[model samples]
Target: MTSLLKQPVVDAINGQVVEEFTASLQYTAIALYFDSETLPQLSGFFHLQAQEEHMHAMKLLNYITEAGGQPIVPATKPVKNHFESVEEAVALALNQELKVTEQINSLVSVAVRENDYLTQQFLQWFVTEQLEEVSSMSDLLNIVRRAGKDLFRIEDWLVQNPHEAAAGGAA
Candidate 1:
């Protein structure tokens, strides 16, 4: 099939794939940190996040192939395995989400610039997803800050609010 995506759009999507895969690895590292700290809820939450990020990368890869563009499976960037505190770890996650949001916006811009209506439409899901991602990460960061020394409070909160906990890991 002829490629429906412009070269620039394909390139941007490939870059996003790298970001998503890196996020998956970072979340895995965070999960491991939580596990080493004996925090089951936090570990579980981050593990789930890692899976979600992996799925996100796969989604982008599938989209690229379905759009008749060549998909590049790139190596992930390095992830920080050690964190001093839960707040610091959550802050790192929040920062990453913010960066990913910007990248997704840039991808949409590229699709628009290239006049790739299909790609633009396809990227809409990611655009909307960023809102939830940022909001969830922001809420989690706030909870982590408020919890402070009471780390178990986060675990308890996660147990109480399963849905919110799944995404943001807190209410």
Candidate 2:
């Protein structure tokens, strides 16, 4: 059998796995912060976000193993749990998703430069995922921004919004 560790594609895959783990931690911290702030709906969204990130990590792990690459244990940093308002949380999410999208794009570029077709193909899913992630976060931010200072209106909007929860579950 070939050693996968020597391959750049394997390194990229490991990096993605680490990124997903970091995302999970970040989302969990966000969820806890929202929960403490008495925003259960927002907390639920972040909880689902955490779950989805965990799933993404597992998917990368499985893909690495299937590709004959040894899975590298990831060291994740603790996520901070402080936000001024609902808009702040949404902005954080948007920023995080954008960062993740850039990371994924970098990985894709690496694969392309290395002429690793398989790795590039695998990254296609991440490209699509980033699109959805950014869009969802943007939508939430827009709604919160439009809701203005009305906490009750924002809470009601969240209560009525269930698509993200369902979509996150599916992801």
Query: Which predicted model would earn the best TM-score?
Result: 1
Residue-level lDDT of model 2, residues 1-171, one tens digit each, is 565433777888788888889989898988898789888888888889999999998988887888788888799866767878878877988898999999999989888888877778888988998888888888888888998887666667777878865554685
Worst ten in a row by lDDT for model 1: 162-171
Query: Residue 28: error of model 1 in Å?
Result: 0.4
| 10 residues in a row with least lDDT, candidate 2 | 1-10
lDDT agreement with native, every candidate: 0.88, 0.82
Model 2 stretches with alpha carbons more than 4 Å out: 3-6
Error of 2 at 145 (Å): 1.4
Error of 2 at 93 (Å): 1.0
Error of 2 at 129 (Å): 0.8
- Residue 131 in model 2: shift from native, Å? 0.7
TM-score of candidate 2 versus the correct structure, residues matched by position: 0.91
